[model samples]
Target: MASSAAPAPPAPAPPTPSASSTTLSSDGIPTLLTIPALGIKAPIVVTGTDPDGVPETPPFDRPDEVGWYGRTASPGSQGASVIWGHLDTPKQTAVFLYLRDLRPGAQIQVARDDDTEATFTVERVATYPDDSFPSDLVYNDPGYPALRLITCGGGFDRATHAYLSTVIVFARLTAIGSSANGSGTGPS
Candidate 1:
């Protein structure tokens, strides 16, 4: 039987924090990314689309790392910031192997080179076939700081040696700087 529980309506994204004024005007080069809910804390590596226009993935030898697409908005910027990772290697599970397990309202923290972190709240997760991936929705600027984390999912094809679909986690910036429990020691 097909599972109707694949996903229900996602809980509303957590409200934007109002107590902190640490929002930066410019982009911050993301260095590290964390998802406490999933126990993921991985170093980020820069990548870009190949000449053929496919976004690059982390190297096979470094499957545990994340790839930040340089052509898109950096975290903390008012646009779509994209990050990607491998679902697995031929030999073992990789960094984003369990990406589909993340639920709405989960937090994703990206620590940047500017010493500030952009915290995003999960809005929803969706999956689509690679041939039908929504580029306009996934790549366009949404007029606010947003994030898109992508990876391969669904049944792996032995003939093509690839998964048949892409999993995307859409998030919106909900916190900046630092202050409260999720933040650091600042004036409260």
Candidate 2:
């Protein structure tokens, strides 16, 4: 049965970070994520990977909670940090239901357990096919503090019972806030 059939094409390579990235070490656990432009304010919960090696999300019962991948660098750390949230459940909408509406230059604030806050500026928001998820792009170390916010997007396939794409928002750390120091500022 060796017919003249070409093998499937390889997946696309993940994008690399530019040379401007700088070093910024992690400090504390993130407790909340707030996006003023999206009117999003949710509690951040530490989550592990699922059997599929994807970051686990909060249960349907707690649609308002967002999940941070505990295995990766915490937000505002020296690498890309990942946070995931649900778009919607069969019954209700979740924390990131409108994530696709985010635009560049938007501010994303993450409050930490130590009463500190890390603020990030949106660089880009993109939607990608789930079949070829960009693991390297989302998890890569960018030589600076970066953040990735993921949520289900695109059309829902009834037969597959899943979303066809994922919405990822990429941002870099621009500031940090603390009660002791008043506020920690980073490069513009």
TM-score of each candidate? 0.82, 0.82
Q: How close is each model in CA RMSD to the real structure?
A: 8.0, 7.9
Spell out the clash pairs found in candidate 2.
Answer: none
Candidate 1 accuracy as TM-score? 0.82
What is the Cα-based lDDT of residue 94 in candidate 1?
A: 88
Clashing pairs in 1: none
Q: Model 2 segments beyond 4 Å from truth?
A: 1-27, 179-184
Query: Model 1, 1-188: lDDT tens per residue?
Result: 00111111122232233333434445467888899999999999998766555567778788779988777778876667788888888877889988999999999988888777788889999998767777766777776778899888887778768787888999988877631234632222
**Local distance difference test scores for all models:** 0.74, 0.75
What lDDT is reached at residue 2 by model 2? 9
RMSD of 2: 7.9
Residue-wise lDDT of candidate 2 within 31-113, one digit each (tens)?
A: 88999999999999998755545446677788899888777777776777888888887778888988889999999988888
